[model samples]
Target: MYLPGPVYDVVSVDIGGQVLAPEQYRVDAAGRLVRVGGGCWPDCQDMAAASGEPDTFTVVYRVGLPVDQAAVAAVSELTCHLLKGCGGSGSCGCKANRNIVRYSRQGVDLEMPDPQIIYSQGRTGLSLVDLWLMTVNPHRLDSPSRVYSPDFRYPRVQQWP
Candidate 1:
């Protein structure tokens, strides 16, 4: 099974209410939960045999990066801006004009905010979102913040010695 990756750590592994030790399994670089040594999982044709009596193997791990409220708001505002021009129109593939150019007796004018430009730089046009990200997570990392501690033990599958 393919597991979503960049996982911070595996919290626990349980089989029928029995918690397995960290040594029993390891998480590979590809983020696969692989059984190691004499683990409980077996290579058996029958599903019953693969799962020990009373059957159930559970892997508890953190999933996805952190998404704060600021990000949500930023995305929402951007979406709103993009959809602003579409008034009462159904989803008929019509989108708001990226560049609104108009001419008047006084002068010609243009009104457009390039969201693509902001997104390409890992930034949202919204000031609050950009500020929040800058304060909490600099470097514009798309992944969640990872805090490593010596006291905390994590299971790892070593593909090579």
Candidate 2:
């Protein structure tokens, strides 16, 4: 299958763990990693860079087909895959890989999507807002004395009159 973004290879459970797969490698002429040949369509270096920052991350939505329920289910499925992603769910702010991995069917009810982004602001390198946005537990990696999310911001929508 085609994994849409760059394979940042969430390899181990931590930022500094041994890797277990082929990831972004450079090509002499290419200068950047050759991701096109790999299954990853969009290069992931940019996203990874953002994730490793102090207070930045992104949430993206892509709809392959607009109306099919199955297509919608793909969102949940994709989200599940993301949650199950290799880096051991440390910062992607998602449920344990089990819940997402075992899910075979998809529906809005089963979908509690989380962010694909990460930041280094809070105690665990992420804020509660980040976790909440990604449907992940803010205390997943807590050490019993962690404080609130550092980047917890409540942005309201502006209604134009």
Candidate 3:
């Protein structure tokens, strides 16, 4: 079975309340869980029981791309930007000039980009943070895209009494 995300590691796999040994299955590079030794996953499981109960299949895994040097740099930049003037004097530097869309002093003029516009475009005001965001998610999707079909068997959920 293929997992939805880029799985980093599989911690455990449980079926019918029994934790399967690592030798029983292996996760492929593409995040597909393949059964080993000719064993097969159950075609159907009882959903009424809580996960890990009898007739349940559960997979514990970590998802996401592995953090690299570029990711570390991006996060550090964002953290520094957010922590600006956090431990300073009575005046918080970060708070000053936050809402000044336009400013003029001594024949000098400056215009600040509106924060709402940046937020609406799924970007942070910080350049490094926004660059990293754009590199990773150019489309600015809130979640991964999924295809739905009427024939698909979605898990049952008790929605109403």
The local distance difference test score of each candidate is 0.64, 0.36, 0.78
Error of 3 at 42 (Å): 1.0
Model 2 C-alpha lDDT per residue in residues 1-161, reported as the tens digit of each score: 23244433322211222221333322222122233245433223243454434333232223232234544454565565566655675554443553352344555335433323223433222333344534433455554464688688644322110
Model 1 misplaced regions, further than 4 Å: 1-4, 8-12, 17-56, 60-62, 78-94, 102-161
Model 1, span 1-161: residue lDDT tens: 33576656788876765788887777676667777785546333334534433456666788655567877777676677558636566342236464544435557565545767867988765677678768777888778879989999776555311
Prediction 2 global C-alpha lDDT: 0.36
Model with the higher TM-score, candidate 1 or 2: 1
lDDT of 3 by residue, 67-149 (tens): 87767888998778667657564243466666889989999998888877988998877777788888888898889899989
TM-score of each prediction: 0.38, 0.15, 0.53
Judge candidate 1 at residue 19 and give its lDDT: 80
Candidate 1's displacement at residue 24, Å, is 13
Per-candidate total of colliding backbone pairs: 1, 4, 0
Please identify which of the two predictions, 2 or 3, would achieve the higher lDDT against the true structure: 3
Q: Model 2: how large is the Cα RMSD against the reference? A: 23.1
> How much is 95 displaced in model 1, in angstroms?
2.7
Model 1 CA lDDT for position 30: 62
Best by lDDT: 3
